[model samples]
Target: MANVTAKDAMQIHGRNPQHLVEKIIRTRIYDSRYWKEDCFALTAESLIDKAVELNYCGGIYGGNIKPTPFMCLLLKMLQIQPDKEIIVEFIKNEDYKYIRLLGSLYLRLTASSQDCYKYLEPLYDDFRCIRVKNRSGSLVRGHVDEFIDDLLHEDRVCDVILPRVQKRYILEETGEIQPRVSAIDDLLEDDEDTEKESDDELATSTRDQ
Candidate 1:
């Protein structure tokens, strides 16, 4: 019963939301001790405590294929199908990086292509460093923005196959979403302005001479 998705839960991506995680991975999560103990009877509201306690982000690890707390909570979120507003608040959370990551992953798995881009793209600016446990069970260094990029472009992340989403260019072409204006564009514009100023100064000096 613990592994079953909530009875009234709506379908996500045209199937059970938990199906977003592969069955094999989901089985391993069910067998995990964390799921048996910490995640027992967790409601959408109570899940916040577990999310806050997460120390790192990762999928399965080690020769035994152990599930990380991050993955455990991910499946639980799928099982419960928490309210979109609650998940949005999680995405907006600044206090806990893992909480933000949790929400971002949930959105990626369930939301439409446009909604995914709308929400996850902004997180590219979230540069906070996060530790990710690799398949070998060793903790590795990474940043939040790097993870977000993987979610946007990579086919798979943290051992889960992400649903295909439209490329930003495709969305822009269809006019479903506006063209992205990046921070780097602003920096390049500033550089051009500086160069123009330098050229004008050099020209005035030459004329005076």
Candidate 2:
């Protein structure tokens, strides 16, 4: 089947990368109409066209556990196992939020803890509002940061149990990673600089008075 993983693809976490998604959900994706039609024979270069159309993220939904188009594309990515540089470009493409998210999810599934933290943590500042469809088939509003957080910390996201990610602190202690500086830290530093400027201006005015 064209949908089967590529011949040259390597195992992720000791199994097929597509296996990162649960078997039942993976089956649903394979049987999905979107998979049969839109996703058929899509190459890594061609897949970007479909990814730009996504507006929401989810696994199965409704009573039938229908896989979302987002999930279908995710499975295709795992099947193809596109080059890391290609996936990184997906995350770096700020013009399309779903494309960025698709890359982030792929990284969490296949990349190392260090790689995941390295690429994904920078997106904590994205803060773009997104639509997330739950298992119940209802869409809820969420931020980019929230989705990234769930991918990092939650055991399961969109119905797949994530691969174990080593605790960040452990990596930091072992010197594999440096201490994380959140986007908030940068914002606070900017605020302090502005406040100091105002204080200096006030002192100058008082001296002139």
Candidate 2: residue 103 Cα off by (Å)? 0.5
Write candidate 1's Cα lDDT for 1-209 as tens digits.
Answer: 78899999999879999999998899999999999999999999999999999989999999988999999999999999999999999999999999999999999999999999899888888899999999999999999999999999999889999999987889999999997777678899999999999999999999999
In TM-score terms, which candidate is top? 1
Question: Local error of candidate 2 at 4, Å?
Answer: 1.6
lDDT of 2 by residue, 1-209 (tens): 87689999999999989888888899988889999999999999999999999999877798989999999999999999999999999999899998999999999999999999999999999999999998899999999999999999999887878999999999999999889898799899999999999999999999999
Which stretches of model 2 miss by more than 4 angstroms?
190-209
lDDT score of residue 31 within candidate 1: 95
